[model samples]
Target chain A: MKAQSDNLVEAALETLKASTLRVTEPRRALLRLLAEAEKPLSCEEIRARSEGEFDLVTVYRNMEVFREQNIVQTILLESGKQLFELTVEGDHHHHIICRSCHRTLRLELCFGGELERYASSRGFKQLEHKIEVFGLCETCSED
Target chain B: MKAQSDNLVEAALETLKASTLRVTEPRRALLRLLAEAEKPLSCEEIRARSEGEFDLVTVYRNMEVFREQNIVQTILLESGKQLFELTVEGDHHHHIICRSCHRTLRLELCFGGELERYASSRGFKQLEHKIEVFGLCETCSED
Candidate 1:
């Protein structure tokens, strides 16, 4: 896991270099945090894990830069807080959120094949699609 | 369309009454705006459409309130801006975001199905996922 995380960090650094963003400790720390995090984390969670080395504003600002450069994806949690994750470049996917526990499940499927045709039919010009589903997990339902 | 929008407003009002939220003009207007908007709208867009009736802070606050009550769905736009849309009760869906035109297409497949199983195997317990995808549309690709 540690070696894989190192590779993730290296990829993040390359992304930063390619985007012409300055390589800063906070940015590097964020990359490490996301790479190691078991789930999507908010700015507050990232700051807490950083041990106060960075403030919330820094996280927000750097995240904005990362998003603009397509290095990170900001997902809107049902909690209404923005969660950050490293974008899995070249592979598109969707998510299922546990309605009971707020646990997120990421799935890989380009399900917009039908919607693309639907949009063209309406002349609305379909551009993109994001999909998230909320439901009970097996344990939650069992309980 | 106007009649449909009005019904949405009425339904939203009923939802507010069911929740702990206080129904105010700004709140009402925000719900209406979300109901009628073809795509999720940012705070700035909502404020602009509201015609200066509500401040950005008020819009932010109302957004929090509506989201908490489940009266509206908040969309995480690719631009990192939060957008608002009225949730279609009992219907599960996701979106396709166009990278070129910033247009959003809604899709009906529960793509995150396998992720939950994956999480269960990993013992992540109560795993949930939020997924947003961005790419060029057929129109944008042709352009």
Candidate 2:
């Protein structure tokens, strides 16, 4: 899994609290669902996996909040759809997403830190980078 | 410049026609503008730089069409804003966007081709990856 589930729930809640965000039940439930998920999930998928207490809009809003708090990392598909995964503390990696099935595979590889440094030299502060891979997976490729 | 201006206007128009899309005047105008721009531009910026022949909606629709045809690249910023650039024929590169100024810089560095190969070995077909760097640029960092 890209993100480790162990202690993810506790760590995620702690992160929200540290960010001064409210620890509402819905937020807690969202965090728990993401922590247990083996892969990133869309807002629709998140809502389906969630209790009926939260609606689609709530899922979207909460996900956005979580993203800003660094509690979740979002993978943007070529079609502009996004999938959210819980962030394991201090773990930074990319993902390979199947275009057909939308299944995700965690990739341990990341662009080197030199990239951030390169931007730093260009006078950029608070530098960051994002990468996502996309393609047809085995089963879909055979079809 | 990532996209070469030499013959770009003619080439872009021909591309549209070859793709069976209409070679409208607005499209021609946009092609000329982007071919001349040293950097990417947002839709609003594109319209502002336009000849007043096309509205913002026209620029938006045309840019989306260009993206689908691989004639343009869209960089999604952390704030969800997108910057669009004309693609030079056979030219592929990423960008480093400044968070404060919303400006962009072309980066010659790309993740190695081994990434696609790695995904291919993992049973992925037609593999592709996207990378973009983000940070505060010098002017913004000092602000």
Q: Which pairs clash in model 2?
A: A123-B138, A124-B136
DockQ by candidate, in order: 0.23, 0.64
Please give the distance, in angstroms, between residue B138's alpha carbon in candidate 1 and its true position after superposition: 11
lDDT of 2 by residue, A1-143 (tens): 43455478878788788976888999888888888887889999999998577889999999989888888888887767788898776788888889999888887778758678777777778877888788999999987
lDDT, residue A138, model 1: 62
Error of 1 at B85 (Å): 6.0
Query: Which number leads on TM-score?
Result: 2
Scored against the true structure, residue B128 in model 1 reaches a CA lDDT of: 45
Scored against the true structure, residue A98 in model 2 reaches a CA lDDT of 94
Interface C-alpha RMSD after superposing true interface residues, each candidate, one decimal: 5.9, 1.7
Q: DockQ for the candidate 2 complex?
A: 0.64
Interface RMSD of 1: 5.9
Instruction: Candidate 2: list runs displaced more than 4 Å.
Output: A1-6, B1-6
Every candidate's lDDT: 0.72, 0.82
